[model samples]
Target: MSTESIRPLIGISCGDLNGIGLELIIKTVSNNKLLELCTPIIFASNKAINFYRKSIPDSNFNFQQIKDFTRINPKQVNVFNCWEEEVAITPGQLTPEGGKYAILSLTAAVEALKAGQIQGLVTAPIHKKNTQGDSFPFTGHTPYLKEAFAAKEVVMMMVASNMRVALLTEHVPVQEIGPHITKAAIVSKLKLIEASLKQDFGIDRPKIAVLGLNPHAGDEGLIGAEEENIIKPAIKEYKQQNNAIVQGPFSADAFFARGYHERFDAVLAMYHDQGLIPFKSLSHGEGVNFTAGLSAIRTSPDHGTAFDIAGKNKGDESSFISAIFTCIDIIRQRTAYRENRANPMKKLTNRLLANAVDEKIEE
Candidate 1:
C-alpha cells in the first residue's frame, strides 16, 4: 500500500462519561480539519454522546454511526456503539455506571485494536477509582493495556513540545517506589526507552538521561545508596550491552532546573511525579501520555477527566487534540520502521541516494 493512501483508523474510548470525556471528544472532532489526518472512531453509545452534545450546545460536530468496521467513513467522525442499551449519564457526577460504561467502551476499542481494525488509540480521561471492575482491576491505562496485550513490559512516557519524560516506576506508593527501583527493572526500562525512541520517534541514536532516587543523586552515597547501588550499576550494564547513549544518576531537581533535559532526546525519572511535574509544567497543556513497547500504538491526554468542569463547556481540547496527532504520527512511524526492516533494500537505496547527493554537493 502506498504511504499516502494509508490513513490510520484511530479509536477513541469515551472515558468516564460523567466526567469531561464526552465533552472533550466532541470538541476535538468538531474541527473538520482533524478528519483529514486520521479517521476517528469513538467507542461510545449514542446516549452518552447526546448527553454531552446538549451540554455543549454550540459545537457543529457530527458522527456517522456504524455497526460494522467496513462501513466506516474515513472523512467523517465515526461512533461505534459499544452498548445499545440505555445508560444514565450525569455530567460532573461520579457513579459506578460511569465506570461501567467507560470499561465497556475501552473493551470494545481494545478488541478492535487487537483485530487490527484500528491502527492506533487516543483514550479520553477515565476516573481511576470508578474504572475498577472484574474485567479491569488495574490502577490505570498502562497496566490494564499491558495485561490486555500480554506485553512483557511498557513505559509511561509523557511527551510535550520541549522534551519527553518517562517513568521507571508508575503509580506506586512513595514508600514502595524505593523497593521497586531494582537493577533489573531499571535495565529493562532503559532497553524499552531506547527501542521506542528509534522505532516510534525515528531517532537513530537516542540519548537518555536517568534521574536519581534520592537527593543530589544520593550525594555520592551519603544521601542514599540507590544511585550508587542500583541506578549506576544498571546504567553501566546497559551501556555494555548496547551502543545507545545512556547517562546519569543526576539529581532530578537540577536536571530539569538547569535545562539538562535538552541535552538528551528523553529523560527517565525514578517515579511518576518526578517526571510528570516537570513535563506538565512546561507542556502548556499540550502534553500527551504515550505507552511505549506495546504491540499497538496508544496515546492519551496527560491530564485526567476534569470533573470540576464537566458539562460546563470549559474543558480545553488542546491536549486531547495533541494526543490524536501523536497517536497518528506514531502509527505512521511504526509502519515505516517495520517496512524498512522487512525490506532492507529500501535502506540501501536511501544510502546510495544520500551518497549521490553528497557527491553532487561536493562538485
Candidate 2:
C-alpha cells in the first residue's frame, strides 16, 4: 500500500499452447485476487486461450481479447493477439505454428516491457527445440533475456521457497563449466545477483554463500585447484562490498544439507549440477525460476511442461502458483524501491542504514 509501489499490469506469455503453459495459466488466472493485485494481459491470441479453454477440461475462463497494447479494464481479461489463426495444438505435438506463437508471445512480452506499458512479465515454459525449430541459437529464457537486455553479466537463480540457488553457469554441458571459470565473470555475476536480491526481492542486505567448483572444496588443493584458486579469491573480493558478505567454497553436499542454508540470503553454486541438484531436490514442485539482470521483472515456474501429463488434470500447481506469487512480489518490490529512492526522506533513511550497519558490527 506504500506510494513506492503501484499495481503493475503483468504481460503473461503462453509458452506453447499444447504444453502445460495453458493449463497453469488456466488454473492460476481463476483466482480473482490476481486480477485485483495487477492487471493480467495475455500477450497471446484470443484463439489460443479459447482453444485451450475448449481442449482442456476444468478450464473456466473467458478472456476479453484485444488487438493492441492498451490500458484495459481490471475485471475483463485482455489479450494482445499475436496469432489470430488456430495454432495446430495436439497435446504434445510440436508444430511451426506452435513455434510461431511461442516466439510471438515472447516478442509481445518484450515489446510491452520495452515500451514501459507493463511493469513486469511472467513467462510460461517454452521448449527450446520445439520453439526454435532449427534456429534455437540461445539456451532458454534466462540466456535469451540476457541477450535482449544487453546484459554484461547474467545468472539463473531458481527460488521456490526459502531455498534459493544462483547458478554460476546454466544450460551448458558439464564439461564446459571448468574452462569458463574466471574471476571477472564470478565477480560480475555475483554483483548482479546481490543487487537483484535487494532491489527485486526486498532483501535489504543480502548475504550470499558461494559454492566451490570442486568436491570437498578442493580439500586443501587435493580435489581440484579451482576452488582454492578461483572461487576463494572471488569470494574474498566480493566480501568487501557493503552489506554483501560472500561466504563460500563450501562442499555442495554439506551446504544445503543442514538448516544453515537459511542463514544466508542466497547461495552461489559453481556449476549447474552443484546448484540445481540441491535446489530441485529441496524445492521440487513448488519453486519459481527468476531471470536476473533483465530490464524488467520476469519470472517463471521452475518445472517444465509435463508432456506426458499435459491434460490429465494431474499436474501440480505448486511451481506455477509460486511463479505468480513471485512475479507479484518482485514487481511490488521494484516499484517500492524506485518510489522510496525517489523520496528525499526515504533516500536519506536508506543512506543512514547503509552507513550504520558497520557501526553495529563495531559495537
Candidate 3:
C-alpha cells in the first residue's frame, strides 16, 4: 500500500473563529510535508477557511471541502464543514458566534473520533468564557474531553522536547487550590501520570518529580504542613505500594531555576501556573498541551487565543504544528505498546523455540 493509504486520519477542531486557530491550521498544513505524515481533516466550514485564506499573504494553502468522511483525501488537507448556515467571521473579536461555532466544530470532531472515523485530534485554542453555555459547561478541553470520552480521570500534560509537566489541579482558584491539594489527589494524579508515561510515551519506567504547593515546598512545616503532612505522605505511600521511582515535594522555585527538571522523565506540579509558567518559559513556543490517560488521543497548542495578533498573520504556528506531530507520535507509540504487550507468553515461547533450534545446530 502507498504511504498515504497507511497514514492516520488526524482531526482538527477550528478553535474560536475570531482567533488565530484557522490561520495556524492553514499555515501548518500548507507545508505539504505534514501531509506525508498524516491526513488532516479540519472540522470547520469552507466559508471560514476562505475568509482566513484572504488574510494570509501568499500562503499557497489549499484544501478539499467535504460534507462527510466518505470522501477523505489521504494526500491532501480536507475540510469537513460542521455547519451549512452563514456565520459572521470577526477576527480578533470575542463574539457569541465564535463560541457557538467552536462548540459545533469540537463536538463534530469528537464524534468522528468516537466513531473511529479519525485516529487522533489536534484542537486549536478556544475562548473559555464565550464557549460556556448550557450545552457545554466545562473550563477547558481537558475536562470537556474527560466527559466526552467517559474517561475516569485525565491528566493535563504539557509536552516538549526538553521536559514534560503534568498538573495536580487545573483551572482552580488560589484559595480553592489549597483545599484541593490532598494526599488522595496527589496519589491519584501520580497513578495517571505513571500509566500515561508508559502507555502513551512508551517509557518503561518513568522518574517523576513532584513540586510543592508553598513558596519553599512548605520549608519542612515552617511555610506549610502540606509537605510534611499531605505531600510527603502521598509520595511515600506511592513509592512503597507501587515500588515506583517517584520523588519530591520539591521547592517549585528552585526546582526549575536550578535545572533540576532535566534529571527526571516528567514533573507533576501542584497547580496550573506552578507548572505552566516554567514550562512555557522553557519550551519557547514548542510546547504541546497533551491530554494524557484518555483512551482517545487529544492535543492542543499550549497558547490561548491571541486576539491582538488574530488575522494579522503574526500568530506563530510552531506550537500548533507541534501539537499535530505530537498527536501522531502518541498514536504510533500506543499502537507499538499494545503490540508489544499482547500475548507475552506466545512471544516468549517463540523466542525459546528459536534459541533451542540454534543450540541444536551448534551441537
Candidate 4:
C-alpha cells in the first residue's frame, strides 16, 4: 500500500486559545508535505483556527471541518470541532474561556485516542495556571495523561536531534525536590527511560547517564549524600538487575559543559530544571516533550505558551512541528519493535523465500 493510505491519524489538542497554540498549529500544518506522513485531526472549532489564520500575513492555510470521525479526510487537514458555540479568543490574555475550551479540546481528542480513532496525539501548549480547575487539576499534560490513561507512572522526556533527556521529577518545587528524589524514584525512571529508548527510539541497547541532585555530584559525599546514599545505590541496583549499561550521578554542570551527555543514548535528570536547562539550551528551540511509558503515544513542543508574543505571530513552530514528527516516529518504532520481537526470524525467512523463488525461476 502507499504510505498515505497507511499513514497514522494524529490527534492534536488546541491548547490555551489565548496563547500561541493555534498560530503554531496553523504554521506547522501549512506545509502540505506533513499530510503525506500522517493524517492530522486537530481538536478545535473552525472559528478558532480561522481567527489565527487571519493573523498570519499572506497565508493560505486551509482545513476541513468535521464534528465526528465518520467524515475524516485522510488527504486533508481535519478539524474535529469540539465546540460549536462561539467563544471569545483574546490572544496574549489569560481568561477562563481559554482554559475551558482548551480542556474541551483536550478531552475530546483524548477520548478519540482511547477509542483507537487516532494512533497518536500532539498537544499544543497550554497555560498551566489557567487550565487548572475543579474539572482538571493536573500540573501539565504528562500528569494529566498519566491519570487519564491510568498509567502507573510516566517519564517526561525531552527529545531533540542531538540528545534525549528524561526527568525523574517534573514540575516540582526546588525546595520540595529533595524529598521526591529517592532510590525508588530513580530506579523507576531509569526503567521507564530504558524501555522507551529501546521500544520508542529503536535502540537495541540504550546507555543512560544520570545527573546528580546536588552540586558537584555531592563532591563524593562532601556536598550531599544523595549521590552515595540514594543515587549511586539506585544505579548499582539497576545495573545488577538488568545488566544494563547505566552510569552516572554526574555533576550537572560538568556533565553538559564537557559534553559527557554525548556518550550516552539518554540522560536521566533528578528534577525538571536539572535536565531541561541544558536540554533547551542545546536544542536551539527544536525540542519535543514526549511522555514515555504510556500505552498511547503523546508528544508536545518543549516550549510553553508564549503569552508575550501570542497575538504578534512571533511564535516559532519548529518545536511544535518536531513534536508531530516525533509522535509519528515513535508510533512507527513501537510497531517495528513489537513485530520484530514477535517473529525474530521474519526477515531471514523472507530472504530465504526470495532465494527459493529465484531458484525456481532459474529452473
Candidate 1 error regions (>4 Å)? 1-4, 344-363
Give me the overall lDDT of model 2: 0.75
Poorest 10 consecutive residues by lDDT, candidate 2: 354-363
State each candidate's clash count.
Answer: 0, 1, 0, 0
Residues 1-363 of candidate 3 have per-residue lDDT tens digits of: 244444789999999999999999999999877876789999999999999999988798889999889999888899999988889988999999999999999999999999999999999999998998788999989999999999988899999989999999999988899899899999999999999889788789999999999989998899889899999999999999999999998999999999999999899999999999999999999999999888999999999999999999898999998898889778866765776689555545434433443343234
Which of 2 and 3 is ahead in TM-score? 3
How much is 134 displaced in model 4, in angstroms? Answer: 1.4
Error of 3 at 341 (Å): 0.3
What is the per-residue lDDT of model 1 for residues 253-279, given as tens digits with 9 covering 90 to 100?
999999999889999999999999989
**C-alpha lDDT of candidate 1 relative to the true structure:** 0.88
Off by over 4 Å in 3: 343-363
Candidate 3: lDDT of 229?
A: 92
lDDT of each: 0.88, 0.75, 0.90, 0.90
TM-score of 2: 0.89
The candidates, ranked best first by lDDT, are 3, 4, 1, 2
**Candidate with better TM-score, 1 vs 2:** 1
Models 1 onward score TM values of: 0.94, 0.89, 0.94, 0.95
* Candidate 1 local lDDT, residue 282: 82
State the lDDT of candidate 4 residue by residue for 1-363, as single tens digits. 345544789999999999999999999888887887888999999999999998997555889999889999998999998888899999999998988899999999999999999999999988888888788998889999999899998999999989999999999999999999899999999999999999898788999999998999999999889999999999999999999999888999999999988889999999899899999999999999999999999999998888899978888899998899889888877876776789886646434533443343234
Candidate 4 clashing pairs, residues 3+ apart or interchain: none
